[model samples]
Target chain A: MSTWTSDAAALRSTWFLRGVRAAFSLPGLILVSSFIGFAALAKDAGVTMAQAAFMTGTVWALPSMVVLVGAIGSGAALPAAMFAVTLSAIRLMPMVMALAPEMRTGKTRQCVLYLLAHFVAVTSWVLAMERLKRVPPPMRTTYYAGLGGTLVTTNVIVVTVVYAVADALPSAVSAALLMLTPMYFLTSLWGSARERAGHVAMVLGLVLGPVFHIVLPQIDLLVAGLIGGTVAYGLQLWRRKVRAA
Target chain B: MFILVAGFAATDIWRFLGVYLGGKLSEDSDLLVLVRTMATALVAAVIGNLIVFPGGALAHTSLDLRIAAAALGFVGYLVSGKRMVVGIATAESLLLAGLYLNF
Candidate 1:
């Protein structure tokens, strides 16, 4: 009983609270507005409010939600819609890979990792990568939970509220609001670019991501991510060698 | 149910796989760096897709307005001690204001 009490305290320490506090800041706001936008967009695309909220809860990716809703509204085959949605989520693989390492601790069980991975979207993963170093390793998982939990909770509420009121807002307002998610990403991605390699990746992605989407809409994300990332990594390595020489 | 199962499963499977693979690597491993690089790049890709290939009301809005707002937001983040709220607010308001005036 004593050991159990200590473990609980350790997991819910100052770091955990700090994580919650930090998340309640810009990251939480970003997620809330984005999910609200998603709900509105999903509804506009003929998805029911319940379905939009469910997608927001389950898929947790704005692009995938958009794709699924678009596919459904356009009367595409179900398999094709599912396939497109799945393709949009390939980016999460790298995000989860980056997030999983810092989240491991002796106190954390493997089974818990599955639950945590569900919340490993772009906003949470980027903030975690940037801030996890400040946290002690043993408490990292709890800190992550605090942060990821806040965003998810806020998203659920935002999606629900926005879906409920989507029709009342003018199409212009709803349209602009929907852009908030992408706009947040634009700023957050540029703001969070810590290294030259990351910046190069951003520029390349800005070009390649859009171009690929136009050329090959089905697998644009997968193709752009692999090629753009590889080039950024290679360029950074070459620059370092040049500096050395 | 099919959409729920296939859509959720298709994405969730990668998350499961990522946790398994990432747990094996030590912090100092070089492969971890590559993964981080890939993740960052993927984030950039998603952002780009959002800007250029958006599928909803945002898709109809002019690209210049969105780009302008994003520019200001990035600038706001830098100017406001990297405060993400200030940046996003500035950008979002700009986007709304732009839309209101033009449309």
Candidate 2:
């Protein structure tokens, strides 16, 4: 019985390796590119290399980190930076909801799942959700683990490369690399939206940010996001009510 | 950097909260839908902010180029039947090419 249990554990680990490979495929590109961008941002912002890597490992949310750094650089209060980052991470709530069902099985699996959730990024979450149906249930967790693990490792590597080449590289190249982070994120989310309200929310945000930035630069993103998301949610609720009626 | 790290750590507190809460929910409830839509909207808002009022290097490029690249990439993603990799590569490639030309 002990030998059988050991064999089962080994098999699970091996399967996890395969799952990681499958999950890592295209999703890895997104993480790697984003890390390069993060590196550039760190360099331009005067953040140390260790600090950047630490941020990636800890915060793991690029945009929010950027906002936090920007806020600090501009001497914004620490509480404000915390609030902004927390607000930025609000999107992860649903992603966790969606992914949790796929990851959690038994108690031990739940522990692993919780650790795996830390690695969830925009790219891997989408890929995992979309591709999970093709995979067996038990292996889904392993695959997600693999994909996210590769991304975390790649993030460190990319950031290191960017830091190494920061002074040597041309400004244009650094700039282009940095843009890839947001570009990849925006494009990925834009591509994956399935609901009309989601699309509308995006459009509203796109239109409102610039308008608000020109008029109320201090809180354009925060205000636009609140207004846009609230409006979309309200519209969706109304539509549902009408349909029910 | 210190603040950003602390800020991120704070953000992650929510992820941990999610794990605890997620262990006890149905995947297809109305509440879930509400959560999904709210999250989607926030993501949309962030994307919009990036494109429309970019800071840093993206601010150097023409708004037209950014719009065109994003549109082209989005359409490509749709045309390619919602393949995320295809969409991301398409948009990034277009923007890079456009940036190169302008420079």
Candidate 3:
């Protein structure tokens, strides 16, 4: 029993530390810079540093926080702001769904999964999906907890500090910093894709996103994802059938 | 306060639902594949929108420059054995150089 307890303790710390180490990587830097930009934006919108940090921690998703800040900045009503934030956040559902199965094991408790689910935003999702395949299933949850927990805590501190000290960042500098996120996402997705259909879906979404934005502004992302993903999956199915036949 | 309540609920409901639903399905199920694809596409769309029609500081850069940086970054990423840091550095460096040089 003593040996078993020590073994479990060792496993938990090792996996958790691995996750924490991963948080200092490129994705982590990108997450930090993005929030620095966010802090400036929040300050400009007259959001208090406390509020900005709160939103960073609670809302977690950058895009949703942006919408919330924009709504408050514009003096929009509460329900309107809530609706906009909710709509912007709908994308997280599929991301969480994709990640949950990767982290769950038969012995994993439902409540533990729920706690980890709070960290399933874009960067964490991408990082976890990329790395989780190498992790033992039982340790994946612990790994994600460390990664996500470190990211959120670090960003909260960064936002609060940057908010208090920095003048507005130079447009060029801030723009370049902001560009890191999409650039990271694009490269990571391209490199880490498990199948050709993933690539096809990415390309289709890339093309369709802008088109839908022009044609249908509000639900552009939803429409693009549904159509692009379906079409790409259909193509994959067809290819499989052809190979079999 | 309202931001807290609305934002948390609005964003987190999906996460909770995902966990609940994902718990029910096996990892390699066809339905998970669909969900993964949709998620990938959604993120791709977000990247596309951010690049094509950016807000705040990113909007200050020319569209051509943004596209060029992203394209080159992708190439750099591919050529460098998919090192994410290399891609991001190459892109950020190109973007800053372009901005400074008025390219």
Candidate 4:
């Protein structure tokens, strides 16, 4: 019985450490580098380093943080900035929905899932979805907690340090670093897509994003996503019908 | 304080909702599929906007250079068996090279 108990404890630690270790991988490094750019942007927007670090910790979503910074830079009112950030964060809903089930087991508590859900932004979501299949069901939550906790802590530090020294970095270098986030997103989404509909949605969104930006600059992202995704879904349904026929 | 309140509410509410609803929903449900696709598209739109019409420092670079770098990076990603690091290295290198050479 003692041996069995020890084995279980060892297994748990191994899984949790595995998640922590993943925070040093390419995706994790990319996430940290993106925050370097965010720090620079925040500094340029006149946000204090403390506020930037606070946002990074509390907001946890890079895009939402970006939206908040943009809103602040433009001197947008509180309600408007909140709304914009909320809009950008709506994308996290599906991500959490998709991921929650993956990490949940029959014994997992709802509160535990709720706590873990706070870390369901782009990079964590992508990393968890890609790696969770390798984790046993009972240990998935622990693994995710390790990953999320490390990512949040590490990024907060990155923001703090980078914000303090941002003035010294060249515009070109910071721009190149900032560009890494989107490049990582595009490539990962393309690589991990489960179906043709996802590919279609991505391509349509990419094409329509710039077009809608010109036509309706304010709500361009939302409109492009709605139209692109719906059209992709419709095409998927049609293709299924054709195959069945 | 404002960032704390607004940022937390704006982002975490959906996550809480997802946790609540994820328990009841099936993975392959039609609603889930639609939501997933919409989310993916939304993210894609964000990526497109960032690359094509970037703000802050990225705005200093010309649009053509940014687009070319992204395209080449994507090609490199595909050719490298979808390795993310490879894509990032290609794009960052191309972008910096363009900036330095005044291309």
Candidate 5:
């Protein structure tokens, strides 16, 4: 009956404490800023508390949260908003795939993976990928749960607090806060696009996305990503082959 | 509710799928590379929309100012050794200042 009771208790106490402490450092600060920026953006988009709360809690990826607001505020269809948000999340797929191997051990196909997957946003993935190495392999998931849990809770609280107070603030102040969303995405992305292909993809998308939007306002983002991403991937393969030869 | 079912749920599907698949495949595989590339492109597309065809308050701002802010952000990011907050703050301050001065 108590096969893993001690593990669970230790996880919630020591591992969880370690995770929380790590969170309050760099990762926590970055996440707070990004979410604060996003909360402001959500307010400017006229997103309600319920909507923002849902996005913060579930769509925890700051980029996706920001993009959903942008897509919806532009009067895009429900499907379109979902599409953009989904696209923003594709980045996390590769991330979790890379990181999950470290979190689980043995042939355990526990349902814990599905729960952990929700915590695979940029900050958690990056920090956990690094900090999790310090932990025993068996305890990594618990460590991550603690870290990711704190971030999500903090973001939800920040979103609620920011949105609640936003209405009372002056329009200009709110607008400045709103502007922080793109600024955050652009700058943070600059750090992550560390490779040649990533830079190529980003440059192409930057050039092509707006053009596609101008031509076809509805599905521009999707089309641009397909084309630009394919081009970057192709280029990367070609470069690799050339180096091999 | 919509955000829950569609937005978060939709995104979670990918991560779940990834975990299932990652254990079996090599990261060097073409499929994974292509998917990662697509993700990068989509993010870039979002950035484009924000800088160029953005909705909300940014829509009211002029193109020149937006371009300048992005330029400032890029330089600031590079200068700050890729500190995200530094770069974002510089651009945000610039745009807000420009907006204020314009007003």
Candidate 6:
């Protein structure tokens, strides 16, 4: 009983420290940068600053928010807008996989994970994976919780600022801000490409994207990612087999 | 915009769902591996689409211009030992320069 109680306390404390670390990490910076784009989109679309702020607090996903604002601004149908957002968000399923492992212990901790998953994002997931791999399993959950909480706070603050100033920015600045969204994703991929397969996947994605677009515009990204990622994965497996033989 | 709203709702619903599901899923499940590959592929696809068949502001530039900028960014990333900011800045700078040349 004593051990159980101390273990719980230790878990809580470690998690708190992880949250503090999150407030000061690269993921925090990425979130802030991307929110700038979101604010610019909200401002340009004539969405009320308050509404925009509320969206960020709740949605917390930039691509979907961008699609939402863009659709509304362009007078696209609601279903179309929602579909776009959903399609962009399909990425979240994998994100859940990458992050769920960090919070695992037993059945009771599963409930806590469900509560914490709302905070998952590219930045938070990356940071959590990096930190959790080294820490003891008992402390990993607390670290993830702390990191996620810090990210939420940072996002809230950034969204507020961007929404407030949305109307005041020049066209060029607004455009640049919008570009930052994809730019961050692109750059982050560069950082993630440590392995040869990752490098090949990115290059193939980059090269094949435009070519496929010209031939079949509708299914371009899908084709490129499928073809590129498959090739990369297959090549890696093949090479491994050869190495073994 | 309704679509956008729905999209937002759909995505967030998943996010909220994540909070509940995070602890329940096994890390080493075959389902998880399939999901990871699919996600990676999707992102790769999106990036490919953006570069090859860009819409909005990116559409304004020529295909060559976009490709060049992306290449420059890739080279910068490699030369800088894989610094993300460097790769992004290189691409942005190249794109801006292409704009200046075209205009």
lDDT of 4 by residue, A1-245 (tens): 56545545667888788889987887798788888777877876788998999999889998778768766766767887777677667767767888988977779998999999988877888889898877777888999999999999999999999887766778887788678768877887797567788899899888888888789776666687788888888889899999999
Q: What are the per-residue Cα lDDT tens digits for candidate 4 across B36-86?
A: 566567668878877887876888899999999999999999999988888
- Poorest 10 consecutive residues of model 4 chain B by lDDT? B31-40
Q: Where does candidate 4 chain A have its weakest 10-residue lDDT segment?
A: A1-10
Can you tell me which runs of candidate 4 are displaced by over 4 Å?
A: A1-7, A11-18, A45-47, A74-84, A101-107, A129-140, B1-6
User: Which of the predicted structures, 2 or 5, would earn the higher TM-score when compared with the native?
Assistant: 5
Candidate 5, residues B13-97, lDDT tens digits: the string is 8888878877787776787678767778878787787788655566788888887888887798888888877777788888888
Compose the digit string of candidate 2's lDDT tens values, residues A1-245: 56545534556677567656764566666667777877877766777788778777777766666666555555566666676567667666667767877766554456776688787767777777887765556666776777778777777777887788877876556556756655666666666566777777777766776776678666555666677777877788899899999
CAPRI-style grade of the A/B interface in model 3: medium
lDDT of 2 by residue, B27-73 (tens): 55666554455555545555665666555676788888877877787
DockQ (model 5, Cα) = 0.61
The digit string of per-residue lDDT tens for model 5 on A62-113 reads 7777677777777887877787778778878778788888888885355887
lDDT tens digits, residue span B1-103, model 3: 8777668888898788888777465555666567556656766876797789876677888999999999898889889998878888898999999999998
Local distance difference test, each candidate: 0.73, 0.68, 0.80, 0.82, 0.78, 0.65
lDDT of 2 at B68: 82
Candidate ranking under DockQ, highest first, comes to 4, 5, 3, 1, 2, 6
Q: Model 5 misses residue B35 by how many Å? A: 1.4
In the order shown, the candidates' DockQ scores are 0.49, 0.48, 0.56, 0.63, 0.61, 0.35
Error of 2 at A144 (Å): 4.0
Cα lDDT tens digits for candidate 6, A124-167: 77787776766656777677778877777777778888777766
**Positional deviation of A35 in candidate 4, in angstroms?**
1.9
lDDT value for candidate 4? 0.82
How would you class the docking of model 6? acceptable
How much is the TM-score of the A chain of model 4?
A: 0.79
User: Considering lDDT, where higher is better, how would the candidates rank from best to worst?
Assistant: 4, 3, 5, 1, 2, 6
Question: What would the TM-scores of all predictions be?
Answer: 0.75, 0.83, 0.76, 0.85, 0.89, 0.70
